[model samples]
Target chain A: MDEFASIHHWTGARQSAEWQQRRGVVLGIGDDTAIVDVGLAEEGVAAPKRMLLAVDTMVETVHFNDATMREEDIGYKALAANVSDIAAMGGVPLHALVSVSVPRAWGPERMRRLYDGLYACAERYGVAVIGGDTTSSPEHLVIAVTVTGTVEAALALRRSSAMPGDAVFVTGAVGMAAAGLHALLAQRVDGAAEAAHPIIVQAHRRPAPSVRAGRLLAAHGLGCHALNDVSDGLASEAWEIAEASGVRVVLHETELPRSGSMAAYASETGMDPLEWMLYGGEDYALLGTIDKTSVIAALELFRKEGIPFFLIGEIEAGDAAVELVRARAAGVSHSGKQEKRVQLAKRGYNHFKR
Target chain B: MDEFASIHHWTGARQSAEWQQRRGVVLGIGDDTAIVDVGLAEEGVAAPKRMLLAVDTMVETVHFNDATMREEDIGYKALAANVSDIAAMGGVPLHALVSVSVPRAWGPERMRRLYDGLYACAERYGVAVIGGDTTSSPEHLVIAVTVTGTVEAALALRRSSAMPGDAVFVTGAVGMAAAGLHALLAQRVDGAAEAAHPIIVQAHRRPAPSVRAGRLLAAHGLGCHALNDVSDGLASEAWEIAEASGVRVVLHETELPRSGSMAAYASETGMDPLEWMLYGGEDYALLGTIDKTSVIAALELFRKEGIPFFLIGEIEAGDAAVELVRARAAGVSHSGKQEKRVQLAKRGYNHFKR
Candidate 1:
């Protein structure tokens, strides 16, 4: 089975609400930060205090490269990975807890560099590193970053809240990470000097997060119904939003945004550029749905804020399928699967199947 | 040069409040959770709401078995690892977010089983699974569990709170996990048939968090000035508490509790039983300090509450050291190294290390 099929089968039997009675779990798995409801300080309040929390991990070889990357970049990327989740829910990130599995051979300077990187990222994002655990491992370094944020009950965007007819949108460009990875690996493939110094490398190393855009969307009453970050590329994540929200997304082929880095890498590799644009991972951008009526104004607002994002598709009332609306150059009807999905198959990234 | 030495060198130099402020961090690296004061909630609270958060990662081969472990056990142990951290701090755990990295070959059934295990553990601990990311990898399964807990301002315990003369104590038996792992590995080596048994496997599989002990300790006035879990064995953690609290400790060997299982495993493996007891990890027990006068009463109350615990040592004014008082054997003396660590040469539960 494909990645989505397998995920569906696995998550299908999951009963998220069955465990809700456990103390402090205000919100369960289907949302951004599992909301932990607490009444520690408030006395006789009719409602419980809702808080959000999440944890994410990065491995040395899997999520990043320890040898080539700056310690600061690793630290920043680790924290950014979690912050993006908070942003997806239209929440304000508050603090972070970090735990690391350091290789025994790594000396003090490496740790300091890692910390320096963490410090820089935390400061840039306004989140504090409150607590952490450190231990030695024989091999790869592992970093687990947990962050907490808060959102008003009325405005919190969730993955399960999308309504039919909502429009699909994504923040920034996608596929830059995929392109950047290709560029980085190509440099190593032939022992070629780092000749193609591209911006895609930066995108893969540190794609900016959309915390500000999410908050702005929430505050402006832009009718965003559901939200999630595009860490796992656009096509795969679009399918996720559709499945979670029970909507079908029909994406326009011409509407997708490809960063210059993505295009250049595709050209250099002789691969379909749009596939990378749609299916790349670690972009750390937001993929959200808003009422179709609110799209134009939302676009204008993002433009005014200098945030590069675009409306790419619509949530339709049908089986969850992503369709490409390309006029056939020759007069021949085509299957949506063949014309759209197969064309973008290279971009799809799944954790279990990638 | 060693793990502790590296940690000390990395942390000793860059202690700065300015770094915290510049990062928009209200709290930075040394606290229970770095506090980044966020904007006021629209609910209009009289005071800013405080949230406690933490993240920890569990690797498949490094932290658990890739070949023989059950999915539920994997999930439970992964979440429990982080929950144990919250419990050590005298906090009430609220919610958790878990990020998982698994190989594509693991299959949907394995994924579901893992989720089932996580759900079971979360339900028991009163924590909800919030949001997280999942991706495919070619390596062993990696789980990063982030948990959030809450406490009133006056109640939260921190590592830096220990004083010169605090009494040191631990909840429940130590070295059970080290013993457990040793038993499992030995059974594998000897080709013991019972290695497939559920209970024996589960002992190495799922670890219960000490939430009750933490809550009781925090609620009562029985002071535990410094707190951390017995994750890296008693001797190693004792040194950490001593160093963090700025004191030394002396352990009476007779006071250290040893289970029959631990003794049998040691005897079978031809390993020093005491070494396993002293240097084992993943006990999931709380090791902490309080006033010397309150030790007996605290232990009694714990017994009444059906929480198992023992007082094994005392904190003193001197360079931090652990002096073993001979019970049935010769006493062993340990002191903080120049690196400020009462070093344990071995790290617990790393599979690939020779």
Candidate 2:
């Protein structure tokens, strides 16, 4: 079974029982993060601070190998993945518990470097590594991080809140990390590629989560509706929003954000940049829908804050689906220069199916 | 380095940083659970609710093998371990996030059985399986569970609260799980062992956490102090309490609780039951110290509530150490029936060294 199917099976069982009667659980199972009502508020204040729970795990060969990730990068990316999940819900990360299963052969220095990466990321994000479990693994190394953060109850973002005519936007560029991964896999980082595309490799190694942009979006609660982190590529994330919100998402291919380094890497490698943008994962950019009327204001605010914000798509009234509009090459179609609308399939990283 | 040493290394770094300045964190590392003040209160109430965070991980081959643990049992014990951690802090478990890295060869049915075990334990403890991350492992299956619980801010238990002149106590029998594990390892469950000592095998398979007893102790806040769950054997946990509270812990060897089945199994195998009681881990029983004046009252309360309470030891005014007093054989000592004091070393399951 696929990840979603397995999750649905478990969630279905939970819903069928008295488990659903739990108190203070605002959102569970199907979101980027689970929202729990911590219920603490300033006296006379209306909104309670809700706790956002997010967990992400990285396996050695699956997520990173020796060639792709160093010890510190593995630790940094594992924690950053969870932080991005919290950011998707517009939460400020507070505490994290990091559980690691290290191989027996790893010495003190390697383990220390791994923790150094974890501490570095934790310090950068203002998160305290509160408590965790450490065990010895016989084979591959596995790191699972769980983060708890707080968000205003009402302003917390949800993927199901997207409405028709909402303007979907993404923070920063997408596909840079994917291109970086390709570069690493091809071992093209020797001299020329490494000098020209250092940002791509850095992007792959340590992609920053858009916490500030998420906070800004959350602060503009009236303008932002649905938010998600692009971990499973743009197409897959768009499908998630479409499925969760029950709205059609239409993306303009030419408007999809791409970095110069990513474009250059793709061109030099004879790879399609659009393929990386659509199918490659681990971009760690925030994707969300903004109210159409407030889209201009939101863009202006993001610009003022110096956060990269790109309007990439629009939500339309239709059945749950994601479509991409690509400009046909000149005279390629019978109708000259027509926009060819293609259905985007839910195809990205599936841990089971892969 | 040993587990404690590694943990100290990390915790020392956290202590020296500005990260410790985080507000609302009542406790950090070096505890069974981290306590964060949620700050929500009933109108005009003095104490706020504190959230307890605990995480535990069980790695395949290290913690279990096919001969010892079934798929369902693996899932159950993994979650139960985290639940026990929460209970050690006198907290009520409310939610859990499970992260599992299953071997790729495992079928869907195996995965389903694993979830069944997780759901059963969660349902039994009133914990919602809110969120998790599932990935494929190339070799060993690793399950990490993180649980969030709630306790009254004033009554949350910690290991650093034991004082001189306190009476030490433990709930239920110790070392039953060790005997059970031995029975499983010996493959003695075919006919006589399975029929005569079924409880032993079950003990190892499904060790229950003392949640109710923990809640009772928390309720009797004036009497209880320095609570811990026996995850890494009695001797190791005693050392933890002694080190954390800066008091010497003294226990009588004859006073350590043992089940009849454990004794029988030990006799059958020509093994010392005391050895298992001292160093065999995974008992998951509540161990703590109570005020000397309130020990009688506490015992009476436990008796009235039908909970097994054993007065096994006492806290003494001394440096951090753990000692065991054993009566010398009648003819062996120079003086007849003299008590022999032996220092108990911190020699339980050390993940790193072992």
Candidate 3:
């Protein structure tokens, strides 16, 4: 690892020129600092538009275990989390900086594998590895990634933009990643039990961010209002939108999307699938409200793009609050008792709250 | 620690509406992402100039021990390290995003103290705390901060611009921070040893980045050919400039900046003060080379600002290398023998290496 010398090794001349597509970047990496030529415009045009910035961190044990998670998956998910942030803003991710703390037990091979995963994920999303800091930890591994992207001021979406009568929409299914994580944690390091849960395992280990779908919504500017990626579960994200938009979000539990594996796991484990769908986090799906008038256009756009767009709820005129109606048939209790409709509590995985 | 909730409590709306000087910021914190209007200029004006971006990370034990380092000092140093990068690029830091991984043992009170330190350091330089990610860790405290700043395209300095005949200039003395850390680790947490070694300890725990000095050099365009903050000691940083700029840097041992405390500490410990001057790290002083013709202007500029400007070396024609000279009077050897001039090896604090 010392042969790497410093953080610059990954960001320096050794970095492949594959992700260097943005024309405004003057200097990408390999210096005491990185210089970005932001705000550039053609002659007679106004100054450069604002850039989107966000950062996310993944910790060992708190986020994942090396024993259950592959080395590359950790790197991929660490980077994907930040990419998802950029996508949530309806912007194109351009550059990134990663800071990693490596434990001594993880040898260079593991570090290389970890980086392999990171670079692979970066390449897929066209994000240049601009700069970063690397250091050794006496114990545990940690990664923090900062992503920067560009957005036209008028087109940028926010969580506060949703208004009354807006149709709440989500891209793709939710809760699969959480279920995958649960399956992994329940199984021993042995492969037999994991084989029974390949779908959840893959879903958990390598959640694909809806980057294309987000770009489509952002570019269309067609009725998309508030936008957010579902990292803290469907209910929690709906609550964020509801809180930021100063409106109420009412979701019919029957409309919550569930995968076949999730249903199977629910039946076999006697667990309520809706609970995972509503409260389990890290789905990386886009959740927001669109204008009811533009619902057809939005659905057509998503359909043409070959991505699922689920109409899960709607925005209403009320005090900023999130309301979930658990329908009578939503599920039976784990004890096999029929459940009554209820107001769902706002709770998601807040790893920091331990 | 759930009371702390997320990293946002520290970087959130509770954040004093301070440091909001930049005008083109479309959004800052409390959103899906932060949006900065880069390159904003008036009508008919050319595009806004470039923005500099950099990230730095500090880990527990590898960077500091909780027992010896105060909670606030840890937070301050974490943010300061990134600010130094902005300064090195000759940019005015405008905003920052911090990601912190906290261990439960540190507790909520310590976390609050850390944020207080971080915000205090940022506010002093007019840097806005825009956004951040906070999460729990199994062990160790970790901080990663990304700072973004603005610099005129022409004024931004690079690490690779030192040409032959350039006079190397450093702002203020170097190596005090390292000495301060040594004293702290050697003594108890009680204030006695720290009080006895005030300059060094403060230098170590709260090293200030020479933001104004860097801006002055870059803004004045005063023939400052290359610039970098001295974080990894003079020798290592000099090597970075030489290697990047493709020049030979020669330093006169006697001319190296030395404080009275450093000299006294060296004498009492039977160690060479030159070691600390050449190899001690984290001083956060600006080091660079200027055109020989501009020495007086540079000196006058620094004097007017009441900051120290020292000329300790020169760049010369040769393969990229850093050469240090030590005559017989350099120091008395342990056997009382006089030492000859030698080319010092390139070594400094690289925490990533095991």
Chain B TM-score (each prediction, in order): 0.84, 0.92, 0.83
- The candidate maximizing DockQ is 2
Q: Please give, for residues B20-88, the per-residue lDDT of candidate 3 as tens digits.
A: 323333334321112243444554664445667788888888888854578889888888888888888
Q: Pick the candidate with the highest lDDT.
A: 2
Error of 2 at B53 (Å): 0.3
Model 2 CAPRI rating: medium
- Higher-ranked by TM-score: 2 or 3: 2
CAPRI accuracy category, model 1: acceptable
Return the TM-score for candidate 3, rounded to 2 decimals: 0.84
Higher-scoring candidate on TM-score, 1 or 3: 3
True contacts kept of 2: 0.50
Off by over 4 Å in 3: A1-48, A189-194, A329-341, A350-354, B1-48, B327-340, B350-354
Candidate 1 docks with a DockQ of 0.34
**Per-residue lDDT of candidate 2, residues A1-354 (tens digit):** 777887676545554334444545778888899998644444455445678998999998888887778888888898999999989999898888989898876777787888888888888887888889888899899999999988876789999999999998999899988888777777844444445668998898897998998899999444899999999889999999999999999998888999998998888889999988887888889999999889888888889999999999899999999998885643344566566778998987542233
Least accurate 10 contiguous residues by lDDT in model 2 chain A? A14-23
Whichever of 2 and 3 has more lDDT, that candidate is 2
